[model samples]
Target: MASTDMRDGLKCSICLSTSTDPVMLRCGHNFCRVCIDRVLDTQDESGVYSCPDCREQFQERPALMRNLALRKIMENFRHTKPHQKVIFCTYCVDSPVPAVRSCLHCEASLCEKHLRAHSKSPEHVLSDPSTSMEKRKCSVHKKILEYYCTEDAACICVSCSLAGEHQGHRVEMLDKVSEKKKEKLRNIFQKLTTKREKTKEKVRSLEERWRKAQETAAKEAERVTALCTDIRRRVDDLEKKVLSEISRQEKEESQSLSALIHQLEIKKDELSRKMRQIEELCNMTDPLTVLQEPDTGDLCDPEEEEGDKDTRGHVKPLHDGDDLDVAVISETLSTLCDVITGIRRGIYVAGSSEILMDVNTAANNVHVADNLKTAIWTRKNENRPETTKRFMCNQVMSRRGFTSGRHYWDVEGSRSGEWMVGMCYSRIDKRGRQSYIGYNHKSWSLWRYNNQYSVIHDSEVIQLPDKISSDRVRIHLDYEAGQLSFYELCDPIRHLHTFTSTFTEPLYAAIYVYESCATIFEDWLCNWP
Candidate 1:
């Protein structure tokens, strides 16, 4: 036991093993001769050297001369167990084996056989057997790190704290500082987990809204498809009725013309037979008999003259009933019109009021409904007496016009082959073609000519893409804001165009139906009182 203690006391502080060529400084600190020499050489570049242990300053240099006595003492303990600090290799690619010694400089455990092939320089820094010696020394100061600089958050050695860059820095024990940093990292991890959960919750909410939107769109599509089907069926039935009435008139006219044709054919046959008899008589060689044959005119019966006189340019006119037998037609149209209103009211219950046609403002070619909400364009003039407010052109305005507040209404649009519907000033031209919506500056509107579309303002046309018209068109007018927006009212409304301008006059909902009806519904009128 005493021998072990004595040998351990003789170990070099630099390598923590039996020292080779041991030396003592003026401060009485001991190190291997090579170790002290290297340390002093680094400090000499700055014209300063100090004892590694006590940090005592040197003015010029330190002697590198070996201590024979200390060396002899270390030699005595070299073969003892206290000198058993050599490391064996931990093979990274092959089997594990003992290391000859750990290199403090490289921080790698070397194999026993590798020691002979290694560099012969003392700077290679062989130490006590250890694979975990990497953290034992401060990298920059090249000394055992004895403290942690809390302010700088770094591990530092005694040399660094006393004479190096961290000389005046606040420091603490390494273990205590590590614990505080670990707690901080744990708190950060917990917060990140909470944030992840919040993101997942938001995703779930968004998914639910998306699903509901899809469902609503599907239901609206189904409703519209069914309504259109019924509409087409009723229209087909009406077409058949009108055709059937025309067919009955055609049959009656055909019979009357046939009787006139038969009477003329009989008259032609009688005239042909009598003329042939007269020719035979004149061909007789007996001239006396030919001259005395009671005059070929006397051979003609008096009744024949009467028959020829009566038959000249004779034609009986056929009766073509001008009036259609519309018993079922009138009832069918009434029912269909009622169904249209029902569909409108059921489809829209918010955001707009039902609109109606204005009779006083309707043109001669328009038939305004008594309900005043529908107008069908007749190809011929209705010939009603002209009123002061009646339009002379193919256009009409609503009874109500907006000077303030927001207004929205939908028109049951016509596939009318040609039509234009939009907002116009109440005082817009009502006398000529210029009085038509979009034909003047007072109107801001979309026009559908055939299947194509365009926007018109100040009589200038902006061509738009062609699209099959939607079943309905919604007009959104912000009176105070001076905005006129049009949308194709589908399952979900799609904006087609917008007009932004300052209004100078009250704007009316003006419509033009060229060859069919365009209906607008007000909510109050559509609803039951």
Candidate 2:
């Protein structure tokens, strides 16, 4: 039996109570296994683990062996009479062992098994395993006090539930709060996922637009470059022609100068010889005999004045001669250059026009249906007077007018009467105007002047009453007779009207009436006598 002193009776670093299941670490320090496990479970901000007694660091999952002898001794002591007093659960007192270890702040006790289960449960309020024993606290309330009020953020002892503040508030076991928070977090994540998808769609749309714009810009750049290259090619051709023309002119001038020099030398030699002959003749003493002899030397003189005039007219000064031709050449070159410049300008203008036209056509070609689908349009009742009168007429005619054939009525009958059939027709009339005609068992009418009024008969004009319902009246037009007729029933004898119009283009008429008013129109159409 070792003496039970501070060294021998080492307390658990986690519970700060004497270690019952003592485990000796490699460093010779002893602690309850559960105590060290709790400490290891709690992670600090920096995540380092330290022993409480020696303040020494130990790796997670320390190489420790349990002191089985010490554990047995503690177990024996626990069984002693003084230590054997029953520890009953504060809540549900009938149970000897608690189901869970309530937080100290909440003042609940739990059995060993319950305590172990609760420690791992999300709803449990296990103390931070990384903290020192003295600093350990309930996870939910963070209170060192060994009691909890199950209601509303309150820390209380078992007797505190009856207090006024917590009297009505729903009290739940503190351990369940963690599970609730986790569930709430999951819901938040789900919502965030939906938002993320929407954001991704928007980003995708923007990226698509960016890609399209980039492609368009690239195409435009290519077109501009091609135009520039064509211009450069034309310029190069012009430059080459101009250089060739300059070289040809230089060669021609050199040949012309050589020919002129050769002709001048021959003229000079002839003039010198002729002068000598004239001098010899003058020196002769017997001039009459020399002239008469006509023998040895030539007696003719050179035409100096004529030759000098010809040479002066034919030969040009070197510097001045090229000036006129060069001026003409330069003017022609300048005109060609101007033409090329104009061509370049025109190309640019044409390209610009093409771009503008494309944009304009795209703008004009927008789909009407697509625009309308997203827009709300207002509909006004323009034929209120006619509509009211027609409705009344239809009701009366459908019930009283002659009926023929298998005519069906929709109103005042359910699967027992005939069904009403109707249609509407519209077309251009003779006066270059559009007309609408409606026909039914009750009556027939024409909408002329752009539906402003109804044409009832050929001889008489009648304005539709304001209270008449348009749905009650129907009209039919006969193109062969150039007449429009109305009927109250299928019988021809119940004719309502017959009107003629000076319409040239084919006219369309809409024949429609309420089922209640179909009897008269049906009888008229059936020619019932």
Candidate 3:
């Protein structure tokens, strides 16, 4: 029987075989020269090499130093005897016999005959022949771990239960504790398997939604292409508008599905890891180790209330109806007709008005560009010379006002913050909330807060079903017809909301900017082909 130290010394760390052509590193670790050369080659790209044994890194691949003395010793040892390890009975002094079991209490290996005659005590913990016996004994009490302390969730020996740190705790026999833990582990494993399966199902559902959305988007694209071809040269700009809208809707839906699928996959991976850990614990042979292992925390508990709430509340499963169905075929046809009629009838306006921002009516924080077409919320007060016409709030108006003729102007606004665009009386209040477009009887405007869209007049708001897809809005007013209309410049220009009332005074192009900006386009609907 070879000694443990001699056997370990001869084994190479890399290949775990007896060292051949042994070489020593600067870190004082030895390995076969061929093994070291191969390992060093892998690190060449990093410009540094690390010792496999000590993990000590070197700036460059160190030259291999031959250990001639160690190599000579290895050769002699190999020639004298083939180094194979075997455990024998400690009591067999004259005739050595192979050991079948090792006693932890006695710290000795026993042959079959001796094992049969050995004292059957709790302390004499017998296991398959092993060199390390101290592991079976308690580190604190130096006794066999026979009891499991439930309070501490640790293994305790006889003395540990009676007098040590675990004294007076709820204790159970090791076998009983291990059996209970295994049952729990099995239950946890089953739950994890169920969760993983559910996560897989969620992934499949989202993937299916994604596939359907793509198909719907493709069909929409084809229909739009066919429509554009039919319309030909008369509506070239309309084709680009329709295609862009389709792309935007498809992107939003696909991104949502992708995010949900990613989250489900991550949850599935976590469940798999937990299941593997529980399975390993259930199959463990040592009762003490199984009982002494730390709790798996929330990983083992599948029914956590907070986790369930978060999953249900935040990670909502996308409904089958969440596909990219922006507009049905009939709706698209109707919208196309509206577009053609609006183009031929010239309902927007006969000619474009050179609309510009009124610097005098602008709020202190509102910055009107030099071109007089843009108004931005500067946050800090500009301390503009106070005047009776100046607005107290973040509001601005166009330099021109309308009293009779049909007129329209296109204005672009930020999507993030709050903004309002509409027609208001030139004499609208300049002081309080009444000065805000859409808050009083003198003004009517389409208001946008984030993605929501609505029209407000005389403090009465009516939410619009059409979402804010385009930042550009066309405000059309026919002073003689008593009609004020707002249209979103998307696809086939969608009419948002319209207000009809007799005009009592001259109306001005007005806007309210709260951490937002608005810009009037130089070329308007009158320029469209």
Candidate 4:
């Protein structure tokens, strides 16, 4: 059987019972595995995890170290023997006297009679009968622990705070420390309650968005399917029309060739008849008869009639298949492509308001004007005061960021050196090469340099065709769909490039200027002229 003192030693502070699946923290305190896990879970949102006993904060969740010795001792305790858990008066050496209270200062348990006879001084603090009186006293000084050392995050006696290892450390009475801890816990509780409500609202919003997305996707799919069906039907009709034209040409050419063959056959028959007549005449016995044959101008005519010659010359040849492919099929396909492009352009409506630049993030050489819609690069630095939010490079970000929905903005640039227009996360770097728009993973941009256009993201560059170069460019962003597209603003907007990526943060409009000026247009679509 285990003694009362041994039982107390093996107890868990959380359960006030023998530890089950005992685990030790780095601070040397032991708790049941289940109990500590619950405590840590509650601290997750607080951003500061701490030990339950000492309140020592940890930068991250602490690892649970199993106390194998304690586990074995508990197992042995369960198997050894069963006995009543009762404490006896320390002064009763003759007969068994049950302890009613324990004096932490004296480190002794007492019966009712003995407790009444004991000192009533405050130093002789009495608590419910506890076998582990040593736990409430300082080990080094053998004095009752009455204060909490803020520096050490441990309980200490007055002597320890004054002259012992914890000398000169800030300390507070245990009761006052407990009250402060309760107040902090109450604040955390309030914050948690608010966060819970907000999370619920977020859940509802997300559900609505999910349903809306599904409906939109279904409608779009149906429309696309219908469009494809119509395109196929139109193409089939064109095929039939082209084939019918080819068949008509073939039939006409065949009739002309057949008529010419018939004329040749008739000529052969006529020649045969004339030959027989000549043979019969040669066989004639009298020369007078042969001479009597009238001297005709011609025996058989070899030339075709005027009408027949005209008919032969007018006969048309078969049409070339290549011509059908080029004239009919090519035009049809071109028309289809135009229709599709028009649909693509019409699907997204631009309702984005005027975008304004954030002057706070502008570099020393960059200037914002025209109500924060224009950015110009000055050759000379303005020597502006330094701030962490200010960019050290020739870059500036917009004041507002886009978190959802589609947005577009048009920018007109000067035909000068280099410049860029794009979107970036608000957390983009403010200094060094990484801060350059289009140079880091946090940003994506369309860059114009040396009369060449290109798109860049995460140091990856894609050169666009020179034909897309225009004074004005449009940047379209579908935040929810994770699509960013660039277009050359012309009579018919030409698509330049598209970047697809999953975004985890809000996107802000960003610009980089070098010996150039960029002006963002208010009412981008209306200002097309």
Candidate 5:
């Protein structure tokens, strides 16, 4: 029972057993080095390592100090007495006598029955009975390593100090050196833990920024959707108002025609009555009746038809009429313009450069303008031989390639037809059907067909409802930041879309026109003549 109790006292708190490579924390707690390392890893994000027992936080990873005293005590601890109730006493020669105590000096265990008869010599130190004893001896010197050489950072036996490698090294008893190292480690741990906390703060900040950006993008999309709905409603109202005026004018014209027809029918009936009476009287049989008729129903007077006389092939009322007044039509158009111009948003950057078309890179049917700023698609054109730099389809690139700094330029594109504006590396595919802007990996673009706008890259299409204005489109590039954002330059620049990626090559301004045309030019902060 005494031997079992002895083994329990030396058990490590972490592993609940004897510690392998035991070390001490600044908090004076002992554990296996591997166990403490695992705990430190768990708190690596915060950089605030703490003791499991006292929860004393450290600013840095604390260096572990070898607990030589604890190691020494465990070396003599019994390995065999862990499971069995008792073992035969080393002092006994034969028979099964249970061991109670181990003599550290004599290296033998005595049973309680035998312990009572054992000598009471002070030199014969007693401990719990154990079987493992060879580990205490050093492998090199075949002696116990009781001293620690501070300079060599190693434990050494007495023989090492006399003549071996540690002969002149500064050394102390391992128990004494271990205590000093533990205190020094405590100071180092306190200072280093704070640095890791700063890193954690940075990571947290970046995550928050990303989350807020997502929310902002969602809100912007909703605003654009609502704006488009309102515009559609306004346009419909304008259309209905114009059609209603035309309908009112048509009613006025139709009513006058109906009145003229009624008058003509009445006159016809009066003449027919008169003719029947005259014809019967001419027979002489009713001569008296003809004379008594008193010339009644003499063709309805012409004055009655004089009213609205100009109704004879005349329509001056419908032409230059108030219903078709140009002033009202102009005002309606002005209002429509105001509604659209009011919605343009965002700021335009000042940096810009004039971009010129590269005729050599243009498709064979695409006509390059004299100014080198515009390209028109035509069916009749001089055929050009296929080349590596020229496009297979109706596409062209700017002469200047930007590899650094900020660049902002404007391009006027088709308002009603299909067209594309974007950036691409000079080495983009020149022959494949997917070589067109927005369809390949080397290009990013905003494409429009009628009013529907789409952002495309790597063959993936993201449709946008807001009609991208073709009056003036702005492409902003930040080379160092690896960003390309597109905008519609109106009253307030409206953001269309943005592309972000690490650019590895110089980029050229590319324009693809189909059944349309576009012109690119530099906007030098409104200094253009």
Candidate 6:
């Protein structure tokens, strides 16, 4: 019975009174089970609980040991300790425990009865500790960060959104912004890959074309070199043959002159000896006496007279001998000159001389042919209709056309806005009349013209309706197909009208248009030229 009373008399460390539903804390101290549990829960920080009495920490909520025997004994003797009501709080024990001790104001242990008495008093007010602590937290009041603006797909924060700078900007969560950027990066990567492949193909194609061009240039160079070489060889051979013929002719003339001089010298010598003998015979003094003496007289008399005549003839013509020799030498020199002149003529006639070639003329002809081919290729490959359509869509706000000295105008806005304009001429026909026509959007008029200076006609102005904005107008000319079309701005840029004709002399027919502003007719018309 005494042991039972002693067990019942054991006090709670928290209440400082006889155990009431007592619990053993991790420190082995006894307290009311609910009281210790509340203290343990309130004191927990970082998920660790500490004993109130010994301040010993526990890793987790320790197992609660209920003393059933002590509990039953205390139940039986509940009224025995009624006078010992002054209980100390285990957490704060300088004075008696408050009626409703709370952890809100201070870290103090609480008794069930303490809080009720404390609330009745004006000094203390019952407040939710959890709510008051949460109110003081900075994280709850802080605004979340917005990292992306969805309008332009930009990155920004919450402060930027509230500032009027991003009034209409759509914002996205920061976490999602990274994903969006990553997706964009992936798309860019794909585009880069595609571009890389395209560039590689282009490079390879260019390399192949370069190789082919190199081969062509090499072959052409070789051919040109061979032609030049062959020509030079022929010229050299001709020159050599000409020189040889001249030399051979000169040698033959020299040999013939020497032979003629030798023959003339021998004949002159023979005539000289005969004249001497005749002179000797004619000089005899006793010719008359001898004529009567013998047969020799008759012969001597006739010979003497003939010899005197022959001597006179031989001595008579010594004046013209040098002149005859000079004539023969001049004839030989003239023949040599004629042979040299003929050789020179033949050399020039061969056409192998460098001076005959006009390199600049040949190069110019080649250049002209290349230019024509390039022009033809450009005209064929370019889409004239599509280009014209694009031009129409992008026309200036004001323009004009002239016909018969009369100016027509197409205008959009007052002189305040921007403008653009274009004009083009097509090829002409044999009739000398202007067969090609071009339309201007600003004046809503068409002007027909020739490739030369003549302007055929300008159509009457077709005013644009207010509902149809000039910015939305598009014109297309298909000279090859002999078709003209106008389109309104829509999904497909709706065709307003189309004109088809069989006449196709014009290589290209074009139109001009306007959009935002109007100007003087002079300003617009001056643009055509």
TM of each candidate vs. truth = 0.35, 0.33, 0.35, 0.42, 0.36, 0.27
In candidate 1, stretches whose alpha carbon ends up further than 4 angstroms from where it belongs are 1-136, 144-146, 239-245, 263-529
For residue 261, give model 4's deviation from the true position in Å: 3.8
lDDT (10s digit) by residue, model 2, range 338-437: 7566654533221111111111111111111222111111132223333221321211111122111111211111122222222222211211111112
After the best TM-score superposition of candidate 4, give how far the Cα of residue 491 lies from its true spot, in angstroms.
20
- Model 3 earns a TM-score of 0.35
Top lDDT prediction, candidate number = 4
Per TM-score, what order, best first? 4, 5, 1, 3, 2, 6
Write candidate 4's Cα lDDT for 1-529 as tens digits: 3378889988888789889999988998999999999988988988788887898989999999999988998899879877657999999989989999999888899998898899988899988888988889888998999999999899999999999999989999999999999999999999999999999999998897788679768976997797777667766876776667667666766776688678768978987887888888889999999989977344644453344344556534323233233464455446666555544444444444547898989999998885898999998887878998899999899998888877888888889878999999988999999888888999999999878799999988999876544788989888877889998887677888888789889999999999899988764435331
**Candidate 5 off by > 4 Å:** 1-353, 527-529
Where does candidate 3 have its weakest 10-residue lDDT segment?
A: 344-353
lDDT of 5: 0.77
Question: lDDT of all the models against the reference?
Answer: 0.74, 0.44, 0.82, 0.83, 0.77, 0.43
Candidate 4 lDDT score relative to the true structure: 0.83
Q: Residues 304-366, candidate 5, lDDT per residue (tens digit)?
A: 544424667343331233534556556656777766544432222233445788888999978
Cα shift from native, residue 216, model 3 (Å):
38
Q: Write the per-residue lDDT of candidate 6 for residues 1-529, one digit (tens) a residue.
A: 6755675458776776777777676567767888888887786666878887788888887767887777776787765654423434434456555333344334334567554444354323234323232222223223233456778665554566766466567787767878877999999999999999999999998897689668757965895686667566665666666566667666776677678778768956866776675666567778875355434333343234444355455433212333234444445445555554554433222111111111111111111122211100011222232322222132211111111111122222222223222223222111111222333211222321121111112332333232333343333343333344454434544445444444323222122212222222112212111
Residues 1-529, candidate 1, lDDT per residue (tens digit)?
8877886888787788777778888778789888888888888789898888788998989776667888777666665555454445854347666776777667777786766677867557676678578767887877766679877878898788889888899988776877888899889989988998999998997787678557656865897798788777766876676567667756765776687678767856776777787888879999987777764664475344553343563342333354444564466456667666665645543344446568888899988878887878888878878877889877789877778766677777577557788988887878977887887889988787776678888888887774744757777776755678877766455777777689988888888888767878543343220
User: 257, model 5: CA deviation in Å?
Assistant: 94
Instruction: Name the candidate that leads on TM-score.
Output: 4
Pitting candidate 4 against candidate 6, the one with the higher lDDT is 4
- Pairs with backbone N, CA or C atoms under 3 Å apart (clashes), candidate 3: none
Better of 2 and 3 by lDDT: 3
Model 1, residue 340: what's the lDDT? 66
